[model samples]
Target: MKVIQSFIVLVFGLTVLVTNAQNKIKIEYKPEHPLKEKIEGQSSLNFDFIIENQSKDSLKLTRLEVSLFDKQNKLIQQKFLDNNGTAPSINTIPNIQWNSVSTNLLFNPFPDVNSMTDKLEYTFTFNDSIEIKKVVIPGDYEQATDFILPLKNKILVYDGHDFYSHHRRFDYEFTPIKQLGFTGNFMRYAYDFVVLNPEGKRYLNNGKNDTDWFGFGTDVLAVADGEITAIEMNQKDDKTFDIPSLKDKPLALYGNYIVIKHGENIYSMYGHLKNQSAAGLKVGDKVKKGQKIALIGASGSSFFPHLHFEVRNSINHQAEGLPSYFKNYNLILGSAKKEGTTHTITTGDIIQSK
Candidate 1:
């Protein structure tokens, strides 16, 4: 299956400086495939572009410039990456080094930063062409963390017992009720293959039944320890259920939420809970494994009652998601054609709790 329509991976941690000799600024930007044309608002893509000076003499350059664009060669507006958009990284090393580095010689014409990888037929002004590169970086999954299951062993049962539940993101067609592009932007990935008792949807279908559906929504618990950093609870009436509006709004104050800094650069999100569920989850409040963080219900931005879950490197607070594997879980491969890299999972496997 074709995996990418386009990708603009804004990998952080590049060094930039300006040289006094030629009076040029050093630059670095995250590498992406270049076909991607959209800039998601409040997305988790941490863009780290830097400028620095690397000359035999110190440079007192007073001016800097930057621009962004999409694959259509259309200029893109990045409201966040301003001239002072970012700050210097804390240097534990005694020798200080700027975070941005430019390999191109000084006074070389600067890149538009907005141009996509596919659109570079020529460097419009220079004989040189533009090319973006990717660098390998270690992930923080190696860091210790914690998780709190809401329904306990019910939803994630097969995780320990079967392999079929190894599924991750589900391919979905847009529904009228969907709020974002891929439909709902909440936590569809977290619920992938985690068995949901159709009782919730069933109750909604029963003719004139007063019974509330069971799985429309539920309480989302922490998959690990962390303190609350940011929370967006308010939702719009027009947007599809379960999908919070892409734009920012007033905090609805649904119960509470805790963002524990499990390890370096890792954070988890649990949303759509009851009003009072966040009672014990104060900003600095500490919780343990299996400790109740919140209750399940259809509270904010939801159609049915269920939980939304995800894990990612939150150092810069971007939308990038990390693929996670729980300890002591089994898989049920959903094919007779199981072979190389085929994920095997079953329906009845009991995924033991951590």
Candidate 2:
């Protein structure tokens, strides 16, 4: 039977007998490349939906009102379906190719196709409550290494950026889930190798709290032996560090922050440290490499509790991320050896010291 006939029953408040009665809605989200960086930069207000009527009913959705909000509790915007189409309202899909260096985009003919097979995508805009995508200053980074920097802590490699998706970074995670790998959404860098959560829980999230994350303070650790370089301590929470919108935990946001220097060209950042950075920290204090510089706390501009660590090259207040590596380490990448030391390390390979 043609799928459109099923919709007649849907209007009468009757559950239409879907064509694939047993086939659940199969919808997948494929975030564009540079997922975190792009979303962080384009954090303007907008409404984006990718709904599929997988039941073979040729769904007709109208009056699509999507409630939108701002950092504040004010209702920011709303969206409604204007017309009826057999397919979801995606505009286009494009051929996306990624590598260590650059990304290339090739626009496909059709706008939308199932993620498993399609290229090209269409975008949608929201009501006037939106503006141009904001551009927060990019975070800092130092050059990564081609060598292996051995670490003592057990590692969990999060293949994607979502909930409970930590994989094994350095051999094992000490739990049954370690062997199971990840089972959550990976919006960006799906194939990229990232250090997993050390604490066995997510320390990072999009709530204004210090602990709403899926990978907090676990992997963003000290890169070298260094001292407390500079500490930006404050307890006056700028915004709710613990909420999603006005309705959720509405009283926590950007709780605390700190920065440390490792060497001439290497530095590290520990942001959203709760009140930790404020507790009698002084400049020029001597700190060992592995010593706990600051406790994990949700402090500033955080949607969750996690540490945001990065390596950079300057102390003039700003440094760009350069390629870098650790000393005396070998990586066992998925049962293979990608060995290096004192050079630069890309985000993969199980690492350890001899």
Candidate 3:
């Protein structure tokens, strides 16, 4: 029997599948990299899927089996999940309400295949039967926009575009914004920058006050020449290292942010800024690359003072994020130092402008 699947690609990077069966189950999927990042050494590949029930009867996912293959059709690995009781399920209520279940996967691709995972097979087992989905991965075609470090001098990539970073796990669909009908991972390729002391500690003294942190109040520079599209410069900074609750202050989550339009639909955002730090700048102001825009602070939803930066296709932070690389920087790892130009920097990297 031939199984036909129809796919509808959503604007926000999700591909929705509408099946032929009466008990419809829509699966939305997308890989972090369409294929692999053209890197010399090993790097992790990530992807996720959301399964939504659309049938009158309840559905319970028992197990999820995954098989990965390389370019030459060689099996790299196979694994089964569902250690947490039932894998996923949907409940029927007063209304035709459905509870969606989502899963995320991360793994290093085989180096022999040039870090390429050519194919993926997903077998989803429900209470009655199973369904399979096969996907042929494609190589990345993203023309990464080159940028300059948003801050100058020895900066630590405190949190970056790493597989386990909270930035990687965030998507508007699962956030408080979802209630407002937004759906995209705006910070998928975002970075959090801080300055660590020679001893690798973030602060001194009792560490209770924000001023104890070395990165607090550091000048935030514009990554490129751009027109200021948005600016929020008056949010008050937190008094301590403790992260404040954003339950009632949702807009404060960004903590005095500035968004710049750098042409070609690419916009850069700098968040978690000190109150009134961007005093003279406002929407419609044009700033040159490396211009000082604001000062880093522990404002909004931050636990410590740091610069939260990201590049995205839309001025709206709810849109999809764009991958980017820095023009020139020196990477420091203890006693070793490496120079790079037009390269992607990830979590834990200590970088300085060259």
**Model 1 clashing-pair count:** 64
Model 3 lDDT tens row, 1-354: 122222322422231222332237666565444434443354344444555665554555555666777878889877665434453322211112234433222222221233556776666655534464645364653444457898875888989877677887764445455664445566767899997777777788977888998889888999888899888876789622222333333334677889998888788989889989996999999999999999998777788888899887775434667666787788887888888645568888888888
Q: All predictions: root-mean-square deviation over Cα? A: 18.2, 17.8, 9.0
Q: Over 4 Å off in model 3, which ranges?
A: 1-23, 30-47, 56-121, 134-141, 239-252
- TM accuracy, model 1: 0.40
Q: Compute each candidate's TM-score over C-alphas.
A: 0.40, 0.35, 0.74
Number of the top candidate by TM-score? 3
User: Which runs of model 1 end up more than 4 angstroms from their true locations?
Assistant: 1-143, 146-150, 156-211, 215-220, 230-258, 315-317, 328-354
- Give one digit per residue, the lDDT tens place, for model 2 in 1-354: 556666665553333333232133332232111111222123211111223333323332222233333334345443333323775333222211122222222211221112122112222222211111211111222233222231244333323222222211111112332233422111111112223444443335544453454333333334556766657555433334433331221112225544566566655555556464444767787655555555545455543444444443543312233333456655655555554444323332345554
List the pairs of residues colliding in candidate 3. none
Scored by lDDT, the top model is: 3
Candidate models: Cα lDDT each: 0.34, 0.35, 0.66
Clashes of each: 64, 70, 0
